[model samples]
Target: MNAELLARFHGVIPAGGVGTRLWPLSRAAAPKFLHDLTGSGSTLIRATYERLIPLAGGNIMVVTGRAHRTAVIAQLPEVSDLDLVLEPEPKDSAAAIGLAAAILYRRNPETIMGSFAADQVIRPVEVFQEAVLEAIHTAATGKIVTIGIRPTLPSTAFGYIRAGERLDISGAPTARDVVEFVEKPDGDTARRYLADGGYLWNAGMFVAPVSLMLKHLERSEPELYAGLTEIAAAWETPARDETMDRIWPNLPKTAIDYAVAEPAAAAGDVAVIPGVFDWDDVGDFAAIGRLNPASEETGVTVIGDVKRVYSDNATGVVVTDSKRVIALIGIHDVVVVDTPDALLVTTKEHAQSVKNTVDTLKKNGVMDVL
Candidate 1:
């Protein structure tokens, strides 16, 4: 990696989202990003910050909800106050990431920014860093770059990116033109995409010049761009809080993919760098089971006190926050999460449907547990 190139890079982490699918463990007060879902000792957000520090050094910013301000600061004490961008309300990724880009652009127009989510698990840090370096090198050419993960399975859970002809960039040998961003397809379509071999999972990771990011935002979403611009202007001044409070709630809500990536790809301005590293969003309990190591004797993956969880002829994931002992017998593929106020019991096959339970609780006016 070039020292000069690394000096020009800035990393932005978007850390909002309650992760309803992993409910009971992931709550609005403390989302999945704050927890050690992978049993990796470090929380997801902290790990994400560590992963970027090698490339961006102290030039990193975290964009998250105001509700999580204290917790985020506690987990990432290295993040300076000025580097933490807090939104009064969740306006999705577009506002969160675009605001960071606008502020970086204002600070230094030549800055290359990379946006990585806070609640993802990526392994072999060196591989991920290498791919990000390529992304940065490609972004320096004035094109919006996205790091697309090589799909390991026909997973319908994630969006897909179509890679076109390979590009001939000076420092980015594996860079390629992105044909299009495809939404999550049906099972059959996902399998077909896997067989076709031209598709990569859209990991929502992006690298681009701050100026180019803002240019796309200005063209695709003028109103949002204007609001972010006004806020960025006052970001370094005493009026930062005043401007953010006044304009943040009204900004349009959308993901960076729809707001920037897709449009840029259509305009022939988007490129992709293949990420060969292992990546997981940890969407539900099944993912949690997959990520954690199972006990040899019990065949049960435990996130809490392993001794407290007893199992016989069972295989599943168990997470216990309380001291109460949990025992399972003659069960298969189960997911049991025992929190202080709530207990969730479901099968791994239906793990994705846990969001439906959260919806039902909201409809029933059950806000205490939520």
Candidate 2:
């Protein structure tokens, strides 16, 4: 553990997503977090654990649906059964996080914490480590601190954080209050947001004292908060697991941002910072293309045996032999992903629409592959 950050803060990773957006590759049984494209030589969940090793010790927790328990355990052999907070069904991120908070608060009420979205990628260990340090420093106060990504584009697909003028802190170097939090905006509004220069891509990372989050969440979502509170109170008692088992199923599914930060921002206790490293959530297949260094024209191809296929492609393509042979004659900025059961041929512009196609497939009962 990094002695500087101390063992007071723990980490919570939400890995319960079904990843319907990346259907062909990320199905119900095999989720995207297990995908090897992130290149950490381990699954995304494992990589997430390793990433937080510097700040957390002996208290790392993973909250995931029971469906993925076997895979999560297989991927993280070092993590014990109790380290994972298994959900009976898929509750959205909010419930998952509350459950983690419940567990941690029961053990230690005064600890500070960090929450991570397992799918993201952070490069340059020094910069990423420094960002955590910065967040930790900001968290010393009662406010919730979020590491914001400096905008590279007016991305309509990502949420925006409107950071206000820098808030004066005694020791913290640079941190700004959240002026507003905006969900995914349209193309034009996104462009305006980028040009305006106060917005940041919400990185979905938070550094705050666990007590502060729980207090605020209790006020914002009272019933759910009561359930979590009861669970926290019973943690070491005989009814601890029983309380969680009963309450987790009834907890409302939400994101920490919606149930916690958005409300905290309204109360004027949120802060934002352009993180210290190049950051990415690595949300889908197209990201595989974007993650590679801009100087190198790297590509990812799948299942096709021909050396000549998928040439002239700027990004990558996944070719499954069962479908029409994806012979890319002269295509640029396209990711041709295929499984034996499903195929997706999309240009970069339409990459974000892949999830819509998956929704349509689900509606049509074509979930054989999805």
Candidate 3:
């Protein structure tokens, strides 16, 4: 967040994904957000939160489920019992966000909360802040705001936001009216969307006034609104835990796009702001591999040093859980990942598909590996 924008906003981290993609190392108990996938000094969740500390002090909120609670508690030292919005069950984005709004409302009714994925990487702090400031300004005008990054490639993995007319917001980047949200498009469609202009990669980063989000829920998802409202009201006295048990179990297992965003977009209450920041949602290993250090020969940036030396590739990322060394005698364009229970070796182009290994392992009933 920008310094000026920092004056009146709180940060919200939705750190509740099951992280099935990064299996073997990332388990059901310890999700991807809690793992040190970056090889940097911090976990994805922690680093993401640290980036927001300039804007929000100790008031950050992490919404999580029970399965990963222990790991979240173990991983995030800055977190306290009160700082978490622990959902009783694994409700999707809609419920998780609804829960965050209710809790933030209890603390500060008019708080402006910025939503974070806790699994993305955006460089140059200035760009991230500019994007957020623009979104906040849009939110201030009663529009639910989400940042849209200019797509570098036609990626089918991420959703798309069709950007439209620009708005004037001082100290903010280009703010555009979102025309429509197109869910993950196929390669051909994605390429057309990118080439056709007015399309952006949905960053999943959002900003909204707590009251505005609550109002959106009230307008679009009244049952969820009432259910979480009941949960919040129960916090007043002896009925707190009881109410969560009743309502949280029934929350629709739907993403925010399905729950609230799509409805708001249908009603033309959503806006997309240009996020010219260097951003990447490190959804899988290949994405994480891109963040590796530079090579000695060509100064080519690479991740996972252990395998790079073996393959002799300038921009190589190699990881191994072998107590012994992992050497790439003569290999190129290969990714080698090793864990105590499993090993993965693939070409960089196919690294993202490595998630299929996880699914096969699950089908094989190898619970310990996952």
Q: Residue 267 CA error for candidate 3 (Å)?
A: 1.7
lDDT of 3 by residue, 250-303 (tens): 876767787677777778888888778788777666666676654666333333
Instruction: State which candidate has the highest TM-score.
Output: 1
Looking at model 3, the pairs that clash are 292-302, 292-303, 310-328
Cα-based TM-score, every candidate: 0.99, 0.88, 0.89
Runs with alpha carbons beyond 4 Å of true place in candidate 1: 305-307
Expressed as tens digits, the lDDT of each residue in 1-370 for candidate 2 is 2355466788888886767666677788888787765544666677788888866766688878778888888887777666787777787777778767877877777777888877777877677767777677778778899988888888877899998988776546678889778999999999999999888989888888888888888988988888777776776678766877887778877778899999999999888867757777767666766664322433544433332344554545553545454566556776776667767788766777888988888899987777
User: Highest lDDT among the candidates is held by which one?
Assistant: 1
The digit string of per-residue lDDT tens for model 1 on 193-283 reads: 9999899999999999999888889999999999999999999999999999999988898888889999999999999999999999999
Query: Which ranges of candidate 2 are over 4 A from the true structure?
Result: 1-5, 234-242, 293-315, 319-327
| Of candidates 3 and 1, the better by TM-score | 1
